[model samples]
Target chain A: MADIVTTANLQEPDAFYADLVAAHDGLSKDESDAYNARLILLMANQIGDHVILKKLLQEAQRTSRKA
Target chain B: MTKLFEAPLYPYKRCADQGAGKPVRHPVIVIGAGPVGLAMAIDLAQADIPVVVLDDNEKVSTGSRAICFSKRTLEILDRLGCGDEMVRKGVVWNAGRVFFGDRQVYDFNLLPEEGHKRPAFINLQQYYCELYLVERIRALQVAGKPVELRGGNKVVGLERRDDHTALTVRTMEGDYDLEADWLIACDGAGSPARRMLGLEFQGRVFEDNFLIADVIMKADFPTERWFWFDPPFNRDQSALLHKQPDGVWRIDLQLGWHIDKEEEKKPENVIPRLKQMLGEGVDFDLEWVSVYSFQCCRMEKFRHGRVIFAGDSAHQVSPFGARGANSGFQDVDNLGWKLKLILSGKAPETLIESYDFERERAADENILQSTRSTDFITPKSEISRIFRDAVLDLSEHHAFARPMVNSGRLSVPATYDGSPLNGPDASGLPARTRPGSPPVDAPINGTWLLDAMGHDFMLLGLGIEVPPLTELLGLPVKGITLSGEEIGPDLRTRYLGEAGEAVYLIRPDQHVAARWRKLDWTEITGALSVALGREGEI
Candidate 1:
């Protein structure tokens, strides 16, 4: 029997990242940045934690500005 | 004296026949306890309107018929205080896959737009959704804001009197007469209420038949929907495989054009077909198998006198795009607020006519789109087959194949253009920033209109000045004032990109009813009166 996985099982950051990469057929450098941005948003939506989502968005903006 | 009628499933214990006892009256009486009817009751009750829901069925149906809820539906449910619970139980599907024969033709992801609170789609059984809603209704009933549910109490006859509708309901134990200000029919396709009204249900009915088999499988299938054209097992037939919650899977197989309905029900012939499509080694037991004929039809009119139709009672669409239930929910969403407005005496009687016009148009559009999708998915004639094959063949080599292969338009939101309630488009706004496009959140110069609020008439203006617009019109308005410093880069970009103005008025159903860079009382009041169906407005 195939393993029965729930959303809870897929909630881990590592697992979520792995699934994202797999879904898009691996991540290039440019794709990785976009993927990270999308990942933060998806996590924020699922978690319903707007504070974390806002903080992550701010951090990404800061990093982009610095670069 | 003996009771006139009685039934075990009747939620109420009263046993009295029509003309045998005193009459009972309610503000609104709804038929069917399905998702649509329940949604209507919830909306009306929340607005402090008294309602009574009647269903022939004794209990909630066990199986999941429609499992997909769009983001708009979620917003409506959210207003009823059950959106979070639904989101928690349901699986969010952001991606979909299409298959041409055995080869994967196209795959697309539904990227969640910024500022939208809900995802593109959520998958949960309709039965569970109904159960959750019923529980909420029960709790409200316990708290004194009651919505009476009469299960197994079927409406035997309906009479629309001058001021009210008289319903003759029959339970196992007895019969009773009930009167209500308005009647809404949410019964299934074979709606007795709709039939009583003698409304014409006209549309195309496909000759092809399909067998739906629900199975408990242990195979490793992707969570995305899979459609196979001319699958390996049956070259002439098409098959669809979709994932459900738990270990369940739904498989739809075309049973060919010349299938004998009676013979197809036999398990002997059915098991072999199932095994052939699933392959030899797959171990899965079928829980249920049923055959269904596809039909695309809609009522000529959604409303007649005090009687209104919703859900399957209003229209029926092929299952190819899952448009039936989704469109039904949209109907309730459109009708709910209108009913609330009319019942509250905030709008004129003509406002109710808009509900009929808008929902009939919506149902027709849904049936048309669903028919087009079914034609694309399952081509009937030889010419259609050749065209379908050619399209798939072209998809393999062409760069534009992605859009051709993708069924994204199936899930697209219904656009409200040519609607009587709509206002003239302002010229200065960017072409893409028109109504029905994505909404942007900007600083509240007075009140802010957010797209996250789902379908509703929203007036956003500069603070106290906007109060006159609502006070005079008796309409709800939100005020927002934006300071230069408060606007962030991303927010500013979206606002400028989408709205192209500082202030705008949105419709109840989220189409831009009217918009202005600044509030003009003359234009605003005129638009309000037109939307409310008052004379000499615009």
Candidate 2:
């Protein structure tokens, strides 16, 4: 399963986000935030197991708060 | 009050008028006149609910974007009365071959499963599918259950109200506001409806582009799919060829990372590449060629307020496994029955949310699998490319290599284990016959028992009986008894094996919604309420 994820995983989220911002210029900050939120949600859902997802979400939230 | 068609393109024009002035609205509004949207509309309309379908294009697009229809989709279309037409026009393909540089590496035969009414896949253009649907809709309209098709009209803006949705549409001559109880966007990948709703489409965009040429050919390429890793003519480039009806062949040419897109547009530049691949004295004419880029993306949310998204609007996968359109049709199938129940007031509004939950998961799985396939076929990085080549090299001598080369992941039906609607399968059974899996035939009444015909829910029970399942919920249910001698080994192993003795309710989309060995009306009803969204007295 990890092999599947590692083999086909998209480029780094930050890099993809940067490309998205560049291609779709004139997007508002709110739109960008919404887009980021959706990306996170989709990734979490694909991870499937709720326990691991909850931990990941908590870690993300903590890191964001620290930043 | 004027009837539909009394005005030009009746429903759309009338909807535009009603939008301008207050008028009675329907519970759901579906955008796009394509087969997927029309299938949803047909299901809802048959259940005695009014639905408005809007399309910007005046006429159905010609030729086939999706030429292959799976058996599951055919069953859904059959319920809508257009199934026979699809079967009639489509060329049934039972066998497929995969070639490795002119050598047939592997082949697959999709024979009809026992008791299944149709073949595995049918080849029919998307246009014909839409045409059949349009014919059905028109017939329904004449029968006084009208499905509004607003052609030559565009949805300009979308606004959600507290209990409904307000849509601003632009027609040829004017603009008007339309209100609906709910909205569904079946719009294509570049969905303006999704954009207007401000949802984000997230995924990766491949830098590699392929030239898709639809041409008339006389070459003796067998009725099989051919993929060359590195053809002699275009070294280090990939080429794909597939047979279509009427001597038409669809070819895809990988133009490396650095070729000029403009130079490739000339017929002169493309002819040499075709001749080289086909060999000397090959007779064929180039009809059309265009460059296409693939992206693997899906909308963040499949629903917002009273509006929902389906098909390409929800996710976009590569064309490798033909997952893009097939999965979209599956979305239509999944959402159709749930929406019907909700609109009829038999189910709660929350049941509609589960449509998003289930279909989005299916879409994500599809995109993930397809992206993996693209990587395997055309690896990007050096290490990945080396691994791919190594696999291809081993494929010649190893038997296990054949399955890996076949890309079985693309053909598997998506399982919905994590859906909110799925219940616990407590039966400690083998993996094959687990609950939440496909249905199996069992023995009953001196004969083998099979699933009920038509596209509706089925509840299979053994010994234990619960309160009339569908009657309690005010939804249609077909109850079948699975008892004694007739249960086949495969069937017993597939479904009944899970809960030694239990009741299994199958959703219209052929997914297991809830299952239990003992009759616990409270838990059964609770799962039903969650799956259907409302409670009704039996």
Candidate 3:
């Protein structure tokens, strides 16, 4: 298990949310789901540590289920 | 005051042998007197073949167009005998800074670790490059080499016959008949030759306009590239500033798709834009201004019978990455040697087809890169703009996303990896200077390896002494020994590491045609024949 490190994260949270929403501007529900899957894989590759990535993935899945 | 280069018009001489009675056949006739045509003429003349050049305009380019000369372009120009002058007269730069709204995001140095000669990029006006080439041509002429320049001679009609290419050239005096063994069309993007032949220029046109201005001011701006995406002054638009020689700065501002062209180019409209960018009290003289749209297009094939197209005549790309002229120089570099070999009866005419194959690959690459840079610079949709800006923002803090910021992916030489001219790579060898790759510069004794070779087929011996009697199937091959002290350890690691006595058969354009672990005559001759289009699998 790994702890999530957060420092100076999302200073402009509104702008980041705007960008995140705008990324799926024209995509349908299926396409947006596919886009999110692909984005997760891309970010996983960037975050090469498997233990940390798995922890982050579990946290994200937990938070998303609550939402 | 800025120094401006004036193009000296060469006197048109009427050859008595080429009078109006009958058409006289020339060995080679290069259409257009721009960089590509002049470079081709110089290469042919240097190879001891007589060449004549024809151009409609009596001078160099009207303005400072195509300012970025890459290292590969400089290397090719060095072969043409005018590189030192261009380097001396140009401003060399390698570091580039990218900005997003006034704050600097990231910066990159192209050649951070350098041992070789020539910088990554040199910012010189195109007119000065042409002038240096013209001076070299004149020097070759003074030395009694046959290189004829016919300025104000426009090629109107072109007929590609099976035997040769016949041309109806239009001169100020009158129209004259001329024929050539090979006719090279370098008449630029709006090529009349390509249009006359009904060749289709096909590709994507970026729907954005750029206002390019050359302003002469003695400012203390460093010789580094500055690119901004949505700067404070420009406000949500991309802008680029590059320093050129003679106290001139090239400023490119993205002026979306729709705008009055004449209105955007006026001094009144242009001056306010300059004042906003360069602050107040900066007395600057406007050298030139032009509004241009981006297009990446090319002909289906570069070779058409005896008529071959080179440079912008064959392909055109956006000016973002400086691919338009640098790639044109590569075209000339690739074509010059092959054409000379064909004309001198050393190789078969089929060898010229490789030029079409290789240069089309290069053009496709340039078009792809320029299109990506253009797309990144001026994104089409709102989502794209969001991603681009986000990438820039992330690049400011994160090192991982820094590579996403594309401010004109600068030009580099294209390696012909899958070229038919390449032979199999030996086992346990480094892959930097492999077959189809350009020769990596290494100092041997006193002179550089590139300056030493390129006259003919050269057999470079690495890590071992070269043997004599180097006649490869009745073709003379010059053998040179490399001790690998010039480029230091990099050369040893790249060229010769445990591969005892490696031999490379280099082409006339200084590209590695084939390489072998041992000096085998049969393998050498087989690869050489394939390279010359003689026989075997190509």
Candidate 4:
């Protein structure tokens, strides 16, 4: 079995963040919100295992106040 | 829609006349001459193995059944030596549009990557595909290795023996018995061979039915696939429209299971639906109409001693994903070289078992995707419908949720990731074209990579020279070297993205058996032996 690498193990985090923001560069506020929702769903589908997805979701929620 | 290509029935010859009044035993007898059976025969005949194909029907399929051919399937067909013609004659498209009611939800393009030879999908009538295959078989006949296709011939009985299987065939003139070292059942969903063997197919069946109609019209619709959930023409139900070759349009509409198939198939009923969809004044002629409910299922074991199953005989899937026939072509591709190797005594009988393993894994994947597509298309419960609509609504404004919208995953070739035949991937190697994965298409000096690879064990070196050919002599392997600049950068990214001296050992079916950053002669030999079903597995 392969290791359970989290998104925290991502390389070039700043580049990914820049790209994420650049994706909604031309969109309106509502469009940007919708885009984020869509991105979350797509990522969840790719990470199909329920256990891993739940852990990621909980981690994001736990760090929500910091952001 | 006009029956453009009609199949000519070949007269059956007496099997007993071949060898001094004794029935001439064939190496392999394939029952049924549809795409699957014909493909099996052609593949075997190309390998210099004599094959006999028997079909009860004299003509190609009457309807535009199994219309969509995937890129992977086209590659396999190319290897079989008849893909270019099919592509020339078929309607090619890579982009697809999905609609939620009257609003367009999302559109997707499958071939975002460039430099590939074939498109994402091609829509051709099943008859034309069969006709092309039959033409190919005839060409093989002229070349001395003839794949004898006997029309108006039926296998009435089959008895499996310790060493071989005996088939009792009935023809128009008389009945004859022939022996075969192996039997392949490509007899389709209602396989008579499967029935004769009393094999039980087990799996899930979607309760909804779909109405498919092929109409001839000079419509201005593009050759892209258009699918709608709760289409305006058919309220609260799904509909699909695809362009086929020869100005034919394939329209599939979801129908309730309780609807009477015969009543719904009537010209009055069908015409009204067409009127609603295509507008009343449009001139069109209905060529064919079919009402069907698909079942996602397969036989427990594809290999039953000397008698094996391929295509619909081995498994069935909902037509949602266009998986039924495309996966069938993959089965032909997977089984062809393995069977040839086994017949030539180059591989063990255990090699055939890998076909059972890899193809069943493919079947399960197809079934899973098709089932999910069916569920999303025809939501069962109120909650299911709510979730479906939510995803559909979200897709209209959001790019991320678009992938969640499952109309049909569209057929992709299966990868045998966990198979014993797969060797370990180099630690820092890119994962896309790793062991068990099929190699992506790229151009190497104007020729397609797959075309250059041929149907043999390939040792491909990217930006590095492969080991001397003499070192790997006697094995069925070919070595080729390519600089990253010779092929496009995409080829380098797909094959040698890490920018190092990389070597890959690819199987006859185009699946990568093993790879390493540097050539290891011992490792290549070991992986090649395992791939041939010789001894130690990687």
Candidate 5:
């Protein structure tokens, strides 16, 4: 019964991304990939809903390139 | 092997039953002299019920199996009269630290609110637990209580009669037959009694091997539980470090789904893992090494005609949450008093059905939480693993995510919310001490509140005056009156809350059976009648 929030929840999203990438600076490709996995997990926790997360996953998959 | 397992404490001795040339019928026969079985025997003996305990092994547990004893279990032990010795010998701890990679994520304090007699948890080895229980039985036997422990008495065959169940127990000398008016199977997961009846133990077997290494070392690790997720020493797996008494540390390392168990168990393979965890320079000796894959499963119904199952024989959970033995102890706690009532002719036989009803709910609850913790600690899917790692990462900074970090949601007694035995509930009382919930501990008269509430159907008249009534419908009900002025603040908050006065009918196991805003004898007798499973008939 708790809901997942959407629509620009974070303030200064660009600033947050800058800090996130800076945290991953000087890391190898594998390390950066692991960081990205951790990032997805954090954001998914913030989302905190299974249906909303699946919807966002589909949306991101639609916009992204083929694997 | 640890030094504790070197000696057989209860070496085989020929019992009078073996020499009688025929089966001797005991009032109650309990299988397995482990903690649960011994506790069961002690409870019955304390109630003046004759009980006989049989076990295949003469010694206590080999290693530090089931090291953590929760406060709820300690309370049950207090009722059985050995909780003080366990607390004196056990390493009492209430704090735990968790880690992500190499960095500490967060630390927690299981402060347990306040006013409790026991701490949140204690880390005593299972051997000491059994030893204390056996010693209590010895004391009871000396006191002329008909509680006997027959070592090396293995139940090889079981047959249910119309009134009593017969058992063929194998000892070193020869096989002997015995009968029990009521039989309790407290054997471990692979219960021979369950097998004799061809009952099925149904549930999931987790796909992972864990190496449990108990090591001896003199280190000041602050007597707390430490858990790690994907540390450098063991990549992509979880690890747990728990302190046991007697300079022993229990280390569990996740070995993934695939490993040669024998090769992994070797000291050459295990010592390096320990070195990496407890820095290379630290000196330690391998006390014991074991590789095990646990299953979260249980029997369909605990009661099978006259042969009822308790402890690991009835149900089993993943060991991570400290639930396997904790819940098994709870099963004994739930069962002992009911058997006492039935055998004494104070309650109907249908009351035994309530045990199945309440304990099945407890088993399902433990199994659910245990399976969830297992999945979180050892995620089967990639996405779930990412979430677990994410929670660990977020827990370092965010307080909201910290509670979500499930490092074995430590064992707490289950509240039987919808139990059939539950009677009326007063509206204004606290939900924590509501009907069907265990009474929380408080402070009273320089002693503990739980110690004051002796094991019986007690009518706790808090901030009120209750009439002096001895027996309700042929069953005993003890009354304790604490006037509104004399009671402490902790008892008021736990039992009364905003209510002016409350009368709680507590079961022998200390679970609340009913409560009311005021004392009324009509309602009390109706509740006492229904609490013993005579609801519709009344």
Candidate 6:
């Protein structure tokens, strides 16, 4: 079984956040949600390891609206 | 000190045409002697076409209006024989600092590259631009070029004849009738000629006012554009500060949609606001003050029969991006060559449609850019302001957000990407100097490449052998060759790219008509025909 390395691993956190936000400019609520959905499918293709990909999806799903 | 702009540069004098009982048809008559009109006349006159300029006023424009001129404008003026003088009198600046609510965000340099002849932008008063152009006209007249400037000559009525445009000139003497084979209306924003012709502008109007205050001050502020959004002094409004020549600083503060124009413009109210923005200790004397609203609009078409419109007569934009006058210079540049070619019978009358096609595209580009910048500066809705503030907030910390912040998108010449005149753009050449784009200036041999071209068709061969062809297809096309040491990094990167050798067909207006990897005679003639508005005629 493979493990997902998820210990605050962004080299440029502020830069990434700004890019994420900037890409959503002029987009409505539904458009932004659809864009995120598309982004997920694209990212899944890059991390093609099945076990790590499953672990990442479970981790993201475990986080509810509260956190 | 008395200024050049204060005295009458081209005072009115009664002309033979005004009093000659029977109207004599001129080759070209330009209405309004403002920057656009003067430059238009000079261009036509340089092409050996006699042009007469008529104006309602005898003096240069009063205030420092349209102060920011781009490098493209300078290059165009250089073609008109007065670029060096304008650059000498103007304050050159390229860097701008942006602040969000009193905290400094990021600064930007407009041109970070070298080997270019002119700077990115210059803050010169509009009056000086008019003065320089009028001086050039005087010199052209001395040398006996067919150019005339008749000031205090107002054009009130315009009528289109079967083959020419007739006009009524109203002066102190009396009303006189005149005619023109080609009439150019550069009357200004409130163009009487456009009104007479029943043309109108179509675009959006922003609900905001700006208080422009030009003051003479000795301050420590560097000569850079400084813009603040929602600053403490102007709470919820934006303010801009720029330094000009001779210790003159221009300041503009945004006022909300609903406000009394008269009440806000009073000296007592204006000074206190200045004090708040620039601490109470700064000593400054007001030079010029005015209030204006921003509008981004243009006419449906620029060319109308024998009568054509240029500059403010055809379009007007918010003064945010300096697109107003810079684009006006471009209009003159694009129209002058086409008119000269048409008048000389080198190209057909259909070539005028290409002018309308290309410049109309350019005007759309300017309007689109100006409108975008205006929306970013002045948010129209609640959600818009929130998003703007959020971007400003993130811009300070993240380098990626810096490019997203919009103070103003400064003017650059438009490339007619899909223009009707653009011919075959061979692959593997530099994209910057592709077909329908203006030639990028680079140091070639000992002088600038732009200084060597223009005035006629040119075949530029870089790192390739060019046959000496004086005329091709009965049109004057001069071929010049450069190779070896002449193809430096700057020139190679701009013109050759990785192709190692390229030949370009340059229009009289210094735009690339077509480009190829090597000089092939068949391709050359085909491209030249297409460039002259004769498609597949070869």
lDDT of each: 0.68, 0.68, 0.81, 0.83, 0.86, 0.85
Q: Candidate 1 at B418: error in angstroms?
A: 2.2
**lDDT by residue for model 4 over B198-223, one digit each (tens)?**
88887656556789999988556677
User: Can you tell me which runs of candidate 6 are displaced by over 4 Å?
Assistant: A1-67, B205-207, B536-538
Better of 3 and 4 by DockQ: 4
Candidate 1 chain A TM is: 0.39
Put down candidate 4 lDDT per residue, A1-67, tens digits, no spaces.
3334754877889999999989999999766665675566667777778788777777778879786
In candidate 4 the C-alpha lDDT for residue B347 amounts to: 81
DockQ of each: 0.01, 0.02, 0.08, 0.11, 0.27, 0.06
TM-scores of chain A, one for each prediction: 0.39, 0.53, 0.74, 0.76, 0.73, 0.84
lDDT per residue as tens, model 1, A1-67? 2222233654488986887668667667655554454444345545655565566566667769566
Compared with the true structure, what per-residue lDDT tens digits does model 6 show for residues B1-538? 7766789888889889876988778989999888999999999988889999999899998878889999889999999999999999999887788988868887877775777788877998889999999999999999889999999899888899888998888999999989999999888877899999887877655546889889988666677888999888788888999988888999988886788988888999999989877777898999888887755678888888978999988888778789988988899999998899889998888888987988888888888887777777877776667667766766677665566577778898999999989989989888899999977888988888888886888999987787656778798788779999978789889998888788999998899999988779889888888888878555
Residue-by-residue lDDT tens digits, candidate 3, B186-252: 9998899898878888765655678989998856767778888888767767898899887889999
Clashing pairs in 3: none
Model 4 Cα shift for residue B240 (angstroms): 0.6
TM-score of candidate 3 versus the correct structure, residues matched by position: 0.87
Worst 10 residues of 5 chain B by lDDT: B201-210
TM-score of each: 0.78, 0.77, 0.87, 0.87, 0.90, 0.88
TM-score of chain B of 3: 0.94
- Residue-by-residue lDDT tens digits, candidate 1, B1-538: 2211122333644433345567787778999988889888887787778888888776665556677787767766776768777888887766665667767666667577644566667777666687778877886787787577778788988888887889888887777889888899999777898778666777555546878777778677567776677776556667877777666677887776687887886789777877876678888878667787755677777888778888888888777667767777777777777787788898776778877777777777776676676676667676566556656655555544345442324544465566667664565655444554424433332333343344445665422134422454766654444435544444455444444345556666555666666667777777767777774743
Query: Model 2, B98-186: lDDT tens per residue?
Result: 55555655566656666446556676666668878888988898888857777877889887789988888788777767778889898
CA RMSD (A), model 1: 15.0
How many steric overlaps are in each model, in order? 24, 5, 0, 0, 0, 0
Winner by DockQ between candidate 4 and candidate 2: 4
Docking class of 4: incorrect
